[model samples]
Every structure is written in structure tokens, then in C-alpha cells.
Target: MVDKALNDLLTLWVTIEPIGTVVLFATLSAHLPQAQRRKVALKAVFYSTIILLGSIVVGQIILSAMQIRLISLQVAGGLILFLFALQMVFDFSHERPATPEKGHDISVFPLAVPSIAGAEAIMAVVLLTDNHVYSISSQFVTACVVVCIMSVTYGLMLLAEPILRIIGKNGAAILERVTGMILAALAVELIMEAIGVQRWIN
Candidate 1:
């Protein structure tokens, strides 16, 4: 159980990407007053919690309803995650928001949706809490882990300015690229496990 929880924590950390999110939050909220920035951070985390928790609860059911197999989703997610990792490693600039879109809530648009609770993150929660593979109690534990990760993200966002100043843009880019390499390896492991290659090798 401890091992599994640790694995879940690492997986959530990679997928939820608190460090990258902090940098993005700092950039996006740069113009806002401190009080407003706090509100935006809270809203982003709150919205992300709703989206991610919903995915944990009903994601597998929705997949089953669509006649999709977990293994299939796992493979697809692995591929997508790999591609995302490549983007992170090779071209970090693509993720940075241009000036906030007019009339759009930046908190919900880029921050909550893709920054905090991205497609990879959503797929990760669903895969981690698969109905067939994990018990209700296990799923509940995973949910708690998700909340913990989000709390960390929120905390980092709250400290974004200071953190960014300490790390500098180049440092953050280097860190993000290193994280991308780890994520790339994890993506390959997911594919191998989903395809039973790991079992065969074992």
C-alpha cells in the first residue's frame, strides 16, 4: 500500500506538474494586484479540483460506456504524454500564454484547464483509479493524493513570484526539460505495461 501510494504521488506530481504550473501562474498573474492574484490562484485550484475529482470518479464509467478498454486508453495516453513531453523538452515556449484573451477568465482558461488539470493529468487520474484494477478504498486514497498534489500546486502558485525570482526563467526551463525526460520514460513504461511487454519480460 505504501509503495502504491508513493507511485501514485510520483505519477500525480509528474502529470499535475506543480513546478511548471507555478511558472505559468507567475507569468499569467504578473499584472494583477497581489489580492487579485490570490483570488485567481484559489479559483484555479478549486476549478481544477472539481475537474480532476470528477475524472477520478466517473472517467472509467464513461470510457466503458464508450466501449473503450483501459489498455487502449493507456496506450493512447502514453503516446499523447510522450508528445507532450517532447514539447516540454524541445519547445517550452508554446505553453506560455500570450496576453490574456479579451473577455476570458485567465484563471479558468489556461491556468485551471491545461496548466493545473491538463489532458495528461485527467487521463492520469482515470488510469490510476481504474474501476477494475483499484478498489473503492484505493480509489479514495488516490483521490486524496490528488488533493494533496493540488494543495502543493496551490501553495507553489502562492509563492510563484519569489520562486520564479529565485529560479530565473532559464532555470525553470531547465527544470521543466528534465521533468519532461522523466515523463517520457514514464510514458514508455505505461505503454509497455499496457501492452503486457513488461509482464512478458518479467
Candidate 2:
């Protein structure tokens, strides 16, 4: 049980990448007022948790109904995550506000969706809870791990301002780029695992 818990914790932590979320959150919300930043952070975390938990509950059913294989989902998710990482590393579009008037409600756009509850994170939860491999109780435990990781992510977002104060914008940008590289590596690993190379090696 301890081993399962630890494994789930580590898996969720890597897929969710809370530190990268914190850096991105800090970068995006730097221009907002303190109260607004807090509100956005809370909403983003709440929404992401709901989305991830919902995926854990219904993702398998949806996949089965669609006759989709977990391996296919893993590969597709890896491809999408790779594209997202490339955007993080090379795209400058994220630097522009959605609209000049009010700026985008980034809480929902990037923060909640791809930043916190990303495709990789969603696939991770579904894969972890797979009924064929994991017992119901073990799946429940994995769900709990997901919540714990999200809680840690929320705490990190709450500290974003202080972290940004120390790191500054340029430092945050560098960290984001490094995180993108890590994400790209993770994506490759996912694709390799989906194709059975990982199992062959083991």
C-alpha cells in the first residue's frame, strides 16, 4: 500500500508539474492586483481539480464507449503535450494579452486547462485508475493522490507572488523554458511507453 501510494504520488507529481505551473502562474498574474490574483489562482485550482477528478471517474467509460485503447490515448496525449511544450519553448504568442482592453481571463484559458489539468495529467489519472490493472481500492487511492498533488499546486500558486519577487521575469522565463524541455522529455517517454519500448526494456 505504501509503495502504491508513493508511486501514485510521484507519477501525479511529474505529470502535473506543479513547479512549472507556479512559475507560469506567477508570470501571467504578475500584472493583476493582489485580490484579483488570489481569486484567479483559487478558481484555476478549483476548476483543474474538478476536471481531473471528473476525468478519473468517467474517462475510462468514455474511452470504452468510443472503442479507444489506452495506448492510443497515451500516444495522442503525448503528441499534444509535445506540441504544447514546443509552444512554451518557442512561441511568443503567449506573451500577448488576449485583448488589450481587459486582458484574458487566463485562469480558465491556460492556467486551468493546459497548465494544471493538462492532457498529460488527465491521461495519467485515467491510466492510473485503469480497472483492468488497478483494483478499485487502489484506484481510489490514486484519486486521493491526485487531490493531494493539486493541493500542493494550489499552495505553490499562493506563493507565486513571493516566488516571482525573488526570481523576477527573466528568471521566470528561463525556468519556464527549462520546464518545457523537461516536458518534452516526458512526452517522448510517454510515446515510447505507449509503443511498448519501455515494457520491452523492463
Candidate 3:
């Protein structure tokens, strides 16, 4: 149980990547007032938490109803996450939108969606709670880990201002790029696992 909990926590942490989310949130909400930043941070975290929890609850049912296999979902999610990571790595505007129209209500856009509760993260939670592999109690524990991760994410976003003060724009940009690389690697690993590469090798 301890091992499973620790593994779930680490998986959730990597997939969610709260530090990367903090950098992006700080960059996007830098111009807003302190109160507004707080609101945006809270909303983003709130929406993301809801999304992850929903995925944990109903995502498997939806997939099963559609007769979709978990391996297929893993491959699809990897592809999507790879594309998103490319955007992060190559698109400067994606990191910090210059226009208000593009940046408006960023909490719901990139922040809550692909940034926090991303395809990879959603797929990960579903896979972790696989009915064949994990019991109800284990799945419930995984859900709790998801909430804990989101809580930490909220705390990081709230502290984004002070963290940004230390890192500065250039540092944030570098961090974003690094995060993209890490995500790309993880995506490839997910795809490999979905294809049973490790099992074949063994």
C-alpha cells in the first residue's frame, strides 16, 4: 500500500508538474493586480481539481463504454502530450501571450486544461485506477493523492509572484523549455509502455 501510494504520488506529480504550471501562471498573470492573480490562481486550481476528480471517477467508464482499451488511451494521450510539449518548446507566445484577446481568462485556457489537468495527467489517473489492477480502496487512495497534488499546485500558484521575483522572466522561460523537454521524454515513455516495449524486451 505504501509503495502504491508513493508511486501514485510521483506519477501525479510528474504528470501535473506543478512547478512548470507555476512558471506559466506567473508569466501569464504578471500584469494583473494581486487580488486578481489570487482569484485566477484559485480558479485555475479549482477547475483543474474538478477536472482531475471527474476523470478519476468517470473516465474509465466512458472509455469502457466506448470499448476503448487502456493501452490505446495511453498512446493517444502520449501523442497529444507530445504535441503540447512541442508547443511549449517552440512557441514563445504560448508561454506568454502578448495580446489580451489571446491571454484573456487564461485560468481556463492553457492553465486549467493542458497545463494542469492535461491529457497525460487524465490518462495517468485512469490507468492508475484500472479495475483489473487496483482495488476500490487503492483507487480511492490514488484519488486522494490527486487532491494532495492539486493542493500543492494551488499553493505554488499562490506563491508564483514571489517565486517569479526570484527567477525573473528569463529564468521562467528557461524553466518552461526544460519542462517541455521532460514532458516530451515522458510522452515517449508512455507510448513505449503502451506498446509493451518493456515486456517484449524482458
Question: Candidates 2 and 3: which is better by TM-score?
Answer: 2
Q: After aligning candidate 3 to the native by TM-score, how far in Å is the CA of 48 from where it should be? A: 1.3
Q: Candidate 3, which segments miss by more than 4 Å at Cα?
A: 66-104, 166-202
Per-residue lDDT over 2-113 for candidate 2, one digit per residue giving the tens place of the 0 to 100 score: 8999998998898788988887788667656778778888989889999889888898898779998767867876787677678768855655543323544678756887
Runs off by more than 4 Å, candidate 2: 67-104, 167-202
Lowest lDDT 10-residue stretch of candidate 1: 92-101
| TM-score versus the correct structure, for each prediction | 0.65, 0.70, 0.69
Model 1 lDDT tens row, 24-124: 67755655667778888999999999989999988778877998776785687678768767776787456555344466687885678666787678888
- lDDT by residue (tens digit), candidate 3, 1-202: 8899999999999989999888778766765667878888899989999988888889889877999876786787678778867876886464343334644577886689777987778889989998888899999999999989999999989988887778876786777677778768877887998898979888
Output the lDDT of residue 153, model 3. Answer: 92
Could you give the candidate ranking by lDDT, starting with the highest?
A: 3, 2, 1
Clashing residue pairs found in predicted model 1: none
- Give the distance in Å from residue 82's predicted Cα in candidate 3 to where it truly belongs: 9.4
Output the better candidate (1/3) by lDDT. Answer: 3
- What's each prediction's clash count? 0, 0, 0
Residue 10 CA displacement from its true place in model 3, Å: 1.0
- Tell me, what's the RMSD of every candidate? 5.8, 4.2, 4.3
